[model samples]
Target: MVKARSVVQRIHLLQLALQITFRRTPLGVGMQNECWGAVAAELARLRGETVVAYYGISLREFRELIKGNKLTPAVMRNRVMGFRTLRFAVEV
Candidate 1:
């Protein structure tokens, strides 16, 4: 339960960070606005349902990366959902 809460907190932090950093840019606008959609897709994938796309990743790959501690800030930067979670953060 504690671990689950931490994961939830991390997601929230990432979400807020994204909103603060990127909400105004075109890319950030699209990603931040659709962040919830990414979460929903992940849920569907968890249920073993077929998904066209989940957070910029295929269901299988998403499942694999999430295992153990594979999901990290660096890994998130490389993953679509991470960006989607914190989508629109960090300007180039």
Candidate 2:
């Protein structure tokens, strides 16, 4: 059986996956995809959960929610900056 992961842990895992996409070298891809939406859908299927627990949401809803929401370290940094400045601040 799979061990339960706390919300913080799960979020951190997604963040790491996204951070892997950051380009570290020219012509080399740091990560081709930060596929949170895909992973959650497949994992839920593997666990035989028709619907996600705790969140009371379905795979389809999860996909829609996470769409374009790549929560990487860089992305977090940008968000933190915005909060600190109380304004929209991000580089590209």
Candidate 3:
């Protein structure tokens, strides 16, 4: 059961990581795209993957990378919900 618990914990951490990255990073705001590499690295760490392999996932491959991580539908939905809220809030 420890394994299952860790997975849940990782997902929760990933949520917070994504939220904080999106909330803090100046992504797509007329800034250079270099920061996306940092965002992808942070997420890949939580997803237990190589940062280089997903270095540009934040650019436009987010869903693909998330699918490759094998997260559940609920986690996927939660991610989408959080992303939408954050994106809209930034635009306003």
Candidate 4:
């Protein structure tokens, strides 16, 4: 059975996965594309959830979501709570 992870925990896990993925020096386009799935799988493992639970979309869709500034850390925090809409606030 999978243990439940808190919102903060999930967000932190995602951040770490992104950092790890970005730090890699992939050799080619193919390898670079594969990084997305790698990160998703890593995140799923950390959260004790299936990759589909975090991102039910295809790898391309997930990549676009991240690259298009659609999925920020703040937005992910809301997503963990079942909120789909993105929210932004001036951090002070």
Candidate 5:
């Protein structure tokens, strides 16, 4: 019984972590906005494109992408790192 309770607790914690890491919230809104803004600005400068496209994924889609069995951790890390690099490059 004790072991089962402990397992349940761990599962709950994992779920919470997944939510925080994958979900878009006010907590990370500023960083997200700044990153996308920098990307848009740089793209505009390079291609003279006045309108930038931001693809908004529905909650279900986001969860599917982030939590899908086929998506590896490395892929997710690369995506996040790439975004950060783009943001930094544009700022410089």
Candidate 6:
């Protein structure tokens, strides 16, 4: 249980970090190809895993969503909440 909770915490931290980083970085929030690429690379490096596999979202889809101006703060908040819920479940 402890190990599971640790893993959950790690994942939650990773998601929060990514969310903060992306929001604060002009390149990341702007949806520039280079920015998304950099974000994906950074995530891979930080998590030591492929970004698509870890996030369940492809870079192309992310770029398209950004290009379409479909990204919203509500969606991001929901994702954070979802991860928090996962972390809480593991703790219990």
- Maximum-TM-score candidate: 6
Q: Which candidate model has the greater lDDT, 4 or 5?
A: 4
Residue-level lDDT of model 1, residues 1-92, one tens digit each, is 11122343344436544543343322211223433343444454575643333233344543543331133333233344445445322221
| lDDT tens per residue, model 6, 1-92 | 12233454446445644554446423334435434345544766687866445544445644554443324354353344334323433443
Question: lDDT values of the candidates?
Answer: 0.37, 0.37, 0.41, 0.41, 0.33, 0.45
**Model 4: residues >4 Å from true position, as ranges?**
1-22, 27-34, 55-60, 63-92
Model 2 residue runs over 4 Å out of place are 1-34, 51-55, 58-61, 68-92
Candidates sorted on TM-score, descending:
6, 4, 2, 3, 5, 1
- Each prediction's Cα RMSD? 14.1, 11.0, 11.6, 10.1, 18.4, 7.7
Candidate 4 differs from the real structure by a C-alpha RMSD in angstroms, to one decimal, of 10.1
Supply candidate 2's per-residue lDDT for 81. Answer: 22
Instruction: Give candidate 2's whole-model lDDT.
Output: 0.37
Q: Each candidate's TM vs. the true structure? A: 0.22, 0.31, 0.26, 0.33, 0.24, 0.36
Query: How many steric clashes does model 6 contain?
Result: 0
- Which candidate gets the maximum lDDT versus the true structure? 6
What's the lDDT for candidate 5? 0.33
Scored by Cα lDDT, where does model 6 land? 0.45
Q: Write the per-residue lDDT of candidate 2 for residues 4-91, one digit (tens) a residue.
A: 5456434433443343333242111122442444443444456565425622444554554354344434444333322322211111
For 1-92, candidate 4 gives per-residue lDDT tens digits of 33354465456444644454344343112224433345555666787866545533345544553453223343243232122212111111
Q: What's the C-alpha lDDT at position 31 in model 5?
A: 26
User: Distance from true position, residue 90, model 4, in Å?
Assistant: 11
